[model samples]
Target: MDKETEQLIEKAGKVYSENFSMTTCFERAIFFSWWCGINDCGFCFMSALPKEKTAKETAIRHESSILAETWLCRKLGWEFGFFTGGINAFNADKIESMLEKINKVYGEKVWISLGPIPKKLLERYKPYVKGVVGSVETINEDVHKKACPSKPINPYLKMFETANEIGMKTAMTLIIGLGETKDDFDKLVNFIKKYHISKIHIYGLIPHKGTVYSDADIPSAEYQAWWIAKTRIEFPRIDIQCGIWSDRIERTSLLLKAGANSISKLPVFRKFGTKISYDLEEQTKLAGREFLGSLTKMPEIDFDEIDRFGFDEELTVKIKDKIKKYLNVMKKN
Candidate 1:
């Protein structure tokens, strides 16, 4: 990691471990990731399409490991879920079989995160699953395309409509930074409000390895917090969470202060198949109260935990420097 990122992680540790020590929640939810087999979602490590692998090869190379890992996590008391790649590779029978096998192994813990597939397909799997997560990623269409080119053109609108019509509980995700303006944030919040989405997750862009967006810029800390705080003002009733809390705990707390009621806990998916390391339940225990207090039936969280490490000043300085470096490089290029 770079110097700036190291500083951020250090600050995150202090905030979560030293302050806001309270309840555990992120582990109570299922783990989901961008499982692409249709489109190589340039932002994820597992972006290889299923078609890119042969049928027997895919089943052998990919399926068994994931199945075994899911079963193991379930056995350890965590639900397992998968987000499909893209709508272009939509195959009903294939999905049904995958879920069927998942049910056989893990039973009633599977959640699909595909774009609005045909309604009939969703109806068929409704009985066997918990719920579907429609991670719009961002409500800004231009940003959406720029970030996830392989995604459907109007995924945000269409999926919002479908989730409402289907009456299935929905989890909508938003990625912050990505060069979106405050006006864009307002629009995204309104979109969420109109749909009455059950859960809304906010994520900051973590430019991944071996991707075009690897060098993409992250927003200013103040800007990120501003939008999140604004989101709290927009949807007070919905279950708002800062997705991937393990990625940045301070940011998670800021988003919670802004309006999100929860943080999507870490150990989201197993790396290199079926191996376990990060214990989300234990991590949650150490991750402070500002985050945990927002969960269902918990008392209103006091925002004092924000001061544990005096993070506001140091974090602001570090992020500003990083953002400036990125902007200068972008200009030069």
Candidate 2:
């Protein structure tokens, strides 16, 4: 590693250790994306770009990016890692192959948010994945349809049901401020009670520039906090997470008091123009929660083992170059 990279790693390690009380905990998970293009979801802030490669080539790149992210997660002492891309149909074979590889290295330490998938496919990959997130975004069908024109609400609910039936840990996200009413929360609570979801993520919608919803109004922190507290009261045993996008310390502090016990997808390094206001440790401290480290005891991982996960030399070099750029940019800033 170069000097800048070394500094970042050291700083992250020290801050992580100081903020968190345990060596292994579920809250110490990181988030990365396997794909950046749109998945035909109109409400998505991410825009679709023209396809540059065949399906096979795109699949390879996705797998390679995931492997590289895994290596970074291991180095950061995070207990869990998740992949997020907007709802898109994936090549099932390619995704299965990628999950199998990740399971070998991390052993169910990873989760993924794929909008909605088939039941058979979920069952096939359930053993390799720790959890699956099928975000309905809103319980109101009309509101959901308005936000995501291409994706329907019923299938997403079905995906969660299928996950529960197969005994896979399941999660769902509710984005507040999408013109949803109190009735929507009641509907969601009933669904959660019936489905036995292991976790619930609450995020305030960010009106990204150039998106269809860019002109939409942002929800107040107080409004977001109220629902978060309500969810905690309704589901005392389940994990409630404040997502990365809702980053204000004041909001997060209230969320913790109202019963949020976890946070997800903290970045290991801050890139330019990123909106991250606090690191994992800082967020945990703000909420007066203990920051836990890894969830399992294991020997140190060998870096060379990453090569065995399957990536072409060109892809491997590309990932390395990206990492170097990330570190150098942070150093300059």
Which candidate tops lDDT? 2
Runs of candidate 1 exceeding 4 Å displacement: 1-24, 27-42, 46-63, 79-90, 101-110, 220-223, 245-333
Residue 283 in candidate 1, Cα distance off native in Å: 7.6
Q: Could you tell me which residue pairs clash in candidate 2? A: 23-294, 24-293, 24-294, 25-293
Q: Write the per-residue lDDT of candidate 1 for residues 119-161, one digit (tens) a residue.
A: 6776887766666778677777777777677776465456556
* Model 1 CA lDDT for position 32: 25
Error of 2 at 36 (Å): 8.4
TM-score between candidate 1 and the true structure: 0.62
The residue-by-residue lDDT of candidate 2 on 228-291, one tens digit each, is: 7667656656666765443443455545545665655334344322434334345556555665
Give the TM-score comparing model 2 with the true structure, all chains together.
0.74
Counting clashing residue pairs in each candidate, in order, gives: 6, 4
State the RMSD for candidate 1: 15.7
> Candidate 1 — what's its lDDT?
0.52
Runs in model 2 with CA error above 4 Å? 1-42, 47-62, 79-81, 246-250, 265-268, 271-280, 293-302, 305-326, 329-333
